[model samples]
Target: MMVSRRETLRLAALGTAAILASHPVAASAASKVRIGVLRFGTVSWELDTLKEHKFDATNGIDLEVVYFAGEDATNVAILAGAIDMIVTDWLWVSRQRSDGGDLTLAPYSTAVGAIMVKEASLIRTIADLKGKKIGVAGGALDKSWLLIQALARRDHGLDLPATSDVVFAAPPLISEKAIQGELDAVLNFWHFCARLEANGFRRLIGAEDAEKALGASGPVSALGYVFHDKWANENPDAVRGFLKASAQAKDLLARSDEEWLRLAPIVRAEGKELAKLRDRYREGIPRRPVAEEAADAGRLYRVLAVIGGEKLVGSTPEMAPGTFWQEPPK
Candidate 1:
């Protein structure tokens, strides 16, 4: 079989192209981004939706959603570069940024937490919380606790520790103890608060109300996607891709009740619990970046400073300039 030189060259080029197409290294590299998430975290819902919908794949993001038992573990992973990003609050981002850590945040959920009381309880207001046994989730350093402390100082002129018998406990235990009549009220995370509401507790004051009481005009982006600045600077497109997919997931949950119903089982919310979650998600969807929520960020900083004093996040009474990553890499 005699082959012409031109034909041999054509066949050789075709073979090379086929090999390149099949070779893993020669194929387009998929962007890998490891994200840390907690089991019961609401951002997990978005991640679940992203996975179920294949939004990450469609958006050209190879997301590795890593699970963590708690924020401390998650923070440790992030600091060690074992994970790239996590759903965390701006308060943490501010603290890290102020301390010269290379971390930044973009809004994930603006979900506001609440203080819930038993329906039959006589605690009608924050002032009435005086001397009552209260369960506080995430301990005395919890963001909600700090906000409540600020709220009390600003509106009622009473310190939270001086007013209430605060007990630091996990959220589920707080709910259980509240139901068993051991605690007068429970201040917990948003998801826990929603579950408590489903179980018949009433919100004494919501995060938004607390912010308002503290004279904040904008809705605080309480929770956001946090990542190391170095990684983000290196992989801008991947970060933007993640945000795009997440925004789509957030919008889907807000725009369609069907999406909520679909994700109910995965998120462990059923019936009334699911309904409450839908309402809360609708309310908490952040329409803009954290940079746009300046007033609320300032409010959060003030609250953190008030309750945590100089120990929590230093004496900086303002949101750190680079704390919120506003512009995505072009």
Candidate 2:
């Protein structure tokens, strides 16, 4: 269920207190890093894996993960100082920095989303979407929605909002609606898109393609671990510890299918579900920077400026300096 904004703020204020009360540490104990996460998101998966392997203990940090219901709630918790870090998009990081806030992002996943339609649907191109009831997985301000608008303007000389009927809902509901023929197409997160595709939906386009059209040299990782710059500077070792553990977890998944088998229950993978999960994970695992990747962050800045406008990306269409945490703590 979606958390009410007020309830989210309440949780933000009380979450860490609740955790510390239940799991007390000495005043001079190891550094504790409180992270905000969605209860069912991929970050949650990583946290579970970290706990299962006791990676935090091994890395010498007392990590406390607080669960939020959605991205907005997580953002609120981070800004409220209830959590030191969160798994969120670089776009949000850009917004925060533009506001004189000191948040920075680190790479997490390069899982770009897709627009899906039924196997038998007649919508073969962006132009075909005119007057169709499309289901958007995130809010009206979602990146995917902006990308779609950008695509429409560039490719078909059409404004998506004026040309098509858009309905916003959660990814699961969007997928369900598509399956029931209630929606002509759904623009959803990559994993959900993969799941729907595995269930016989067809992909019309993906955000990677949209990025390319917007002049990105290649696909860019959007979601990342975001933290307050001051907090990160003060807790360099803890920051390094978290990254080390996260890299280890990613490496484990990349190296061993057995790891997925072990996590099958948590991921709820079975048969085709297992195959889709494996495909999505492998597709998203970060790699060494390619030449094309160098242009993505900047291109993303421009794309958001043009498509998302000032409301979503802030006053400047340019990416702020130091938006990314370049030097991993030594």
Candidate 3:
């Protein structure tokens, strides 16, 4: 009528095995992916969707979001092994790889900034920007600013920075100054540009347009999910799963206006501003093939190298090999 000790132990082992088999993710610690993100970054909208829709778990991974105050902090976190991935540009990945680091990127957003002007501003062409006060965010090395400069020189033979009163400041400050009429034109980040559009500002030229004018074939992603090659190779499944989850999230955001409404608070927008932000975010989603994007990036790199010099792209005049991560065949 009583079970033996050996039989009891066998039953316990079977029960534990059954539980682990039913929940595979709980059985493996490697399925957890820690991602570093900016505290106010738009990437959070997609990440929040992933969690809300349970995409990560469906993809067989636990997504952990780590927030930092700035981009540099996120970079430090990923490099110091505090997180698995962060959203950044391929240019940065190329720079790091050239300097003996193994970071790689998966395209995130093709959305880039624009040169914005007030509705009544006389700056209708690149030539009109001469002798005007302009504000630029992300400083002298800002990719969009550099691209705009190249565009001005190539198309109009004007040295934009040299001829204009250029002011470089934080994105928010630049946006504020432009609104206050302290600057005649401004080149700011995408989100800020969206806000400016909502407030009646006009886009003189978009970064994507500038790239095309400067010889790129199509829209190229300027930002992506960056991670170390060693870590990605070791956790291939987790990395792929996370990327799949991210893609699913983007699809949802693209198709659903209700989803954008839900994200309004996080994005700090409402009404016209919210709609503008949503539209711009959707527009920025990367749709080109990886190879196509990489080819454009290589061409764009040469242009940037000419202006940014050794300080911006390091010693590599070309985009480093493997700067864009190609998903392994299924």
Best by lDDT: 3
Pairwise TM-score winner, candidates 1 and 2 = 2
lDDT for each residue of candidate 2 in 161-215, tens digit (9 for 90 to 100): 8878999898889889989999898899888888887898888998878887888
- Residues 89-156, candidate 1: write the lDDT tens digits: 77777767776777888877777778899888889988888788889887777777778878777778
Instruction: Estimate, for each residue in 278-309, the C-alpha lDDT of model 3 and write its tens digit.
Output: 99999999999999999999999999999988
Q: Native-vs-model 2 lDDT?
A: 0.77
| Model 1 RMSD vs true structure | 13.2
* TM-score to native of every candidate shown: 0.86, 0.87, 0.91
Model 3 stretches with alpha carbons more than 4 Å out: 1-28
Q: Best candidate, TM-score-wise?
A: 3
Judged by lDDT relative to the true structure, which candidate is superior, 1 or 3?
Answer: 3
Q: Rate the local accuracy (lDDT) of all candidates.
A: 0.76, 0.77, 0.86
Q: Candidate 2, after superposition: displacement of residue 310 in Å? A: 2.2
Residue 84 of model 1 has an lDDT of: 78
Please give the range of 10 consecutive residues that has the lowest summed lDDT in model 2.
21-30
Which TM-score value belongs to model 2?
A: 0.87
Candidate 2 RMSD computed on C-alpha atoms after optimal superposition onto the true structure: 3.5
